[model samples]
Target chain A: MKVLALDTSNRPLSVSVLNYDKVLATTTITTQRKHAAYAMQTIEDLVKVAKLKPSDLDRVVVAQGPGSYTGLRVAVTIGKVLSDTLKIDLVGISSLLALSLNVEKEGQLVAPTFDARNDILFTGLYRITSNGPKSVLPDQHISFEEWLKQLDQFDESIVFVGEDVANFKARLQAHFGTNFKSVVGIDNLPQAARIGIYGEQQRPVSDIDTFVPDYLRLTQAESDWQKLHPGEGHESYVEQV
Target chain B: MKNENSLILSFETSCDETSVAVIKNGKEILSNIVATQIKSHQRFGGVVPEVASRHHIEQITICLNDALQKAGVTYSDLTGVAITYGPGLVGSLLVGITAAKVVAWAHQLPLIPVNHIAGHIYATNFDHPIEFPALALVVSGGHTELVWMPKEGEFKIIGETRDDAAGETYDKIGRVLGINYPAGPQVDQMAHLGHDTFAFPRAMEKNDNFDFSFSGLKSAFINTVHHADQINATLDKNDLATSFQQAVIDVLVSKAMRALDKYPAKEFILAGGVAANRGLRERLDQELEKRDVEFVKAPLKLCGDNAAMIGAAAEMLQRHGAKADMSLNANPGLEFEWAENEEE
Candidate 1:
């Protein structure tokens, strides 16, 4: 199976073409440039390097959100269009799970984090098993301090992964002391090759038309509105209007 | 797939609408599917950027599918892909751009990045073929500008709003009257019911430059309502609406007349969401007829943001060799590039 996988959920963008367990070509760029500007071109280049055309790909895999709203849309929109147009299988891998895949260790607790600004982080807990990174706690938008408080319950040594891990390393070390393991450098970045491999084992989205990134949090406007009308459940305001 | 026909798949998610269209040679719209978020934004009193973006992502693919199915064309039949890339909410614009770019890349088609204002002006093409040197008075919720097009695909802003857009002012004033968001249509309806009692000031009405300023007029309208409220005097809403509408129409018509005398365009185009105002359209039509200039009012249904207009504009841009690669990004503050030697 030929797979084209991409991750534009954060500042670092990764694109890869894979054939089953083999990574044909992969590129990861950590830059300040918007993912929208270079994501399609990066995918095209990686496909060319893999000696494959976009049509040759049987499945499109993407690291679906819990990251930057614009960044998530950039990848998800591309994924949706490509998959729909080419009539191929479309799979969405959790961005946090993709980040956790960088840790190859078996039976190690991993916490993948993306800095969501204003002291909030899009973080999740996962266990790196031989099969893949299994979700111990699903991805969520949370405060860094609050996330650490929740993590304090686990007695096992936690290996923190992701580029944003550097931002909170001091507090993490201060809290967990020697029990905290921060994986720095290239391993912290999301790998599309790993995402493609894992996604290959997953089921494709039943309906590509309704596929959307997992934003993992409500927009500030919605949150403010919900606060004012407490009993109104989290049903979309778009539908009500 | 790859037919001889010039079929273009277009997208317009610049603001509150998620629209997709199939244009044949940029003149005929086979299918133009517009999923509006007006009702969704009514609760917030205006479009929330994040909410708009969310709605756009959800509706883009659905619109694209409907557009293709309605047009009876597949990806292979499309020669190019076009999208509104600027002068809108960045988050909202990116959804369309991302989708367009992927379509272009996947099909190995030319990608045309269209300006939102340009799309509005070209919407007149659906009514009649635009004759050059055309003068377009573009008015909408986000913009108010006098665009001068010397020839096809060339855009230069001759005049513009110094403050709030004409439609934005209408919404702001409407909020004071307990009307819904997008107050232009409601205000227009009310204006026809009553006389212009207040005769609100027309800011920069006689200015040498074609620039407009509605902030002062907006403040004055607000003061009038507030003063009445303080005195417990309930002013007639129809009269208030009439007065405000007259003030806006007078300034717009006067400025258009002045521009027509100077530029001598064969066609004068009224476009954008505010262009749908009945009073403004009638006033411009009367004034343009007196000047013997051809008046091209964009089809009312096509006045608001839509992909059909973007598709129409893309045909003109493509003729001028306007194309973009995968690196194109949504420019929130994008404006028309000044025509050479036309910059003030």
Candidate 2:
């Protein structure tokens, strides 16, 4: 199956085209720019370099949420529209899981993180296996101090990956000591080629019309509303209004 | 793939509405579908940018599919894709821009970038062919402007609001009256049932320039209501509505008349969300009938943000060789370029 995969869930943007497991062409830009400005252009260029038309693709895989809210929408919106218009399958891969693909050691614990401001981080825990990275703990948005407390329970050597790990490197070293491992430079960035490979094993969304990025946290407005009206059903504030 | 009949697929998510439309030659709407988030924003008493963005991403593709299916057209039949790329919530605008760019790339169709305010002015194309040297009074929740167009594709801002927009003023005062969000239509309805007893101040009514200021009027209205509450006296809500509406209309109409006299346009257009006001529409129609200028009020249904109007504006823009590539990004503060040799 021919596939296109994209990730814009952070400052870095990646686009890749593959034929099954072989990546035909891929481009990853680490510099910060408006992802919305160059995401589709990069996809178009990569597809041409891969010598394929948009209609020739069989599926689209996108890195969906737990990062910048606007950045996640750029990729998800593009993925949803391309799949819908071309009548192809659409698969959403967890962004944190995709980052964990950088770890090659078997049975090693991998923690992928993104800074969520106010000392909060969007992070998750995954374990590497021969097949791929498997989620051990789900992705979540929590403060750095709280996340460190959760990691204290695990005794395995933990490898921290992601561009944002640099922000808390000292604190991580102080806590994990000899058990802490970190990957910097290129390996820390997300690779769309890895996303395409993992997505091939996942099921396509049953309803493309209602697909949305998994933003691990509620919007500030919704959180405030919930606090004001406690003990109420947590149904959609949109539907209730 | 250029179709014999020009068919443009357009997207508009500049504000709270996610609208998609297929236009035939820009004049006839094949199918326009709008999914509004007014109910969701009503709880917040105003639009929350984050909530609006969330709603837009969910509704965009749904509207696109419905629009194409209702129009009975496929990607192969489209000549181009157009989208609103400016003067709106950045998060909301990016959703439409990203979707439109993908459609254009997948179908190898030309991509057209349109300004949201231009889309409002072009809504009048459905009513009549806008004559050359047309003058437009554009008013909405976010904007109030007097735009002058010398020809089909040329635009210049002659005047605009110095403070709060006319619709924004209505909403602020409406909140004081305990009305729901977007109280323009309801406030307009109440104005017809009562006399103008409060005699609200009409700011910038006699100013030489076409610029408007509604902040003073908003402050005056708030002060009157708070004073009434302190004195243990009740002022009639209907009378307050009438007084506020009259003050707004007087300033808008007087400034519009002044602009028409200065520019001497062949046609006059009343455009944007506030254009749907019955009082403003009737007053402009009566006032314009006395002059040689032709009056054009946007169709009530098309006054709010919609893709049909964006497609209409894109047709004119395309004829003038306007196109954008995937590098286009939303400009949240975009405004009409001052007309050539007309900039102050």
Candidate 3:
């Protein structure tokens, strides 16, 4: 089975070609906002290198997001179109969960942290055993100290894996000291290869009709519109209990 | 299956509506469902992107199901997925992108990334097969441009909005006249009610190039309203509307005629949300007829943003053997692929 995976859920954009269960080629570009401009060419180059035509793929995978709203959309749109164009099934892996896949640990928790701005971090408390995380943490934006406090309650050494973790490292060391660790060097960032790895262990939704992006924050425009038109209440949110 | 007509499931959530459509053979729209957020944005006087994105999720499922039922097809019958990738609200674009990607993966289909403006332009394909080396004028809420296309799917922006877009000017004028936020439809309606009794400024009417600027005219209208209120002078709203609409129509028509006269193409395509303007369409038809140039315009009902248009554009990509993998991403500002290494 050929699976093409991409991670554009954060500031950086990553794409990879995976066959069966092995990674053949991976390209991750970390920049402020060049994902949309750079992603297609990179994918084309990867396809050329992999000797794959658009129709040879079996499934398209994307790192769905709880971070960078625009980045998330970039990954999702490309994945949808590629899978659709190639006649393949699509799999969506949580970008945060995908971040955890890069850290190889026997008994450590994979804690992925993304900068959410406004003094908040979009974080997930994860643990990677032989099995994936026993349970992925809630995807939410909370203060870094507040998040660390929540982590202190858990009874395990945590390995944080994400590029944004570097931004809060000093404070993180102050909190957990030797109790905390992170993905070494560039492995600290999200990679499409990792998203592919996570997608491998998960199941795709039975119907694409039920899927949606997990944008943790309401855009400022929506909030303003709500304020301007308070006359009628908003339609019910789509999330199911 | 290779010979089977490609089935494209397309989604458009760029603004104010959540739309889904299944197009078979590109020209035939099998099922198209759109959940309008007009009532939701009625109080805001304008679209709120955040609200639009949220609404898209709530509406995408019903739209998808309706498209499937209307098309008489299942995921098993699909060939590829298509979606409007950008040049719209960033938030609004994501909802469609997310759903389309997942379904594409579930069905193991190719993904086609569509430029929304291109989709609007391609909507003409439903009614007619366009020839090469054509000129397309894309006028909408967020954009206004004269794009030269030497062949299908290749676009070159020869001229564009220098300041406020034509649609934005219409909306702002509508606001001054106490009309709805998007003044295009209202202006079109009002233009029919009265004659152009007053002369409004047509900025750059003498310019040889196709570039447009509506800021000066819009400011003039707003200033007129404010000045009238201060001086206690009563201004006829309908006359003002007619006069303003006439000015816009004149400039647009004049520019289009100039483009037709030079670097002539066999056909002229009008596209984007603002293309629904009755005044503009009628004028284009009358003007283009004089030149004996073939004209293609999207159906009025399909003029605004929608998934069916995206499906139409996606069909061309499929014909070119373009395919997207799971990593296909949403591009808020993805320029229309005009030529190699050039983006509009």
Model 2 interface root-mean-square deviation: 3.1
Off by over 4 Å in 1: A231-241, B1-3, B339-344
How well does candidate 1 match the true structure in TM-score terms?
Answer: 0.97
Candidate 2 residue spans exceeding 4 A from truth: A230-241, B340-344
The docking quality of candidate 1, as DockQ, is 0.59
TM-score of each: 0.97, 0.97, 0.74
Task: State in Å the error of residue B148, model 1.
Answer: 1.1
TM-score of chain B of each: 0.97, 0.97, 0.95
Docking class of 3: incorrect
Q: What is the DockQ of each candidate?
A: 0.59, 0.57, 0.14
Candidate 2, residue A55: how far the Cα is off, in Å: 1.5
Give model 1's docking category: medium
Of models 2 and 3, which has the larger lDDT? 2
lDDT by residue (tens digit), candidate 2, B1-344 = 46567799999999888899999887899999988888777777888898899999888788999999999999889888999999999999999999999999888899999999999999999767789899999999989999999899889998999999899899999999999879999999999998899989989888878889999999999999999999999999999999999999999999999999889999999999999999999999899999999899999999988899999999888888989998989999899976554444
Cα-based lDDT at residue B306, candidate 2: 89
Q: Candidate 2 docking category?
A: medium
The per-model lDDT (C-alpha) reads 0.90, 0.91, 0.78
User: What TM-score does candidate 2 reach?
Assistant: 0.97
The digit string of per-residue lDDT tens for model 3 on A74-191 reads 6666665455434468898777878877766756687888888777898887767787665456767788778877788876678888878888888887888887787787777777
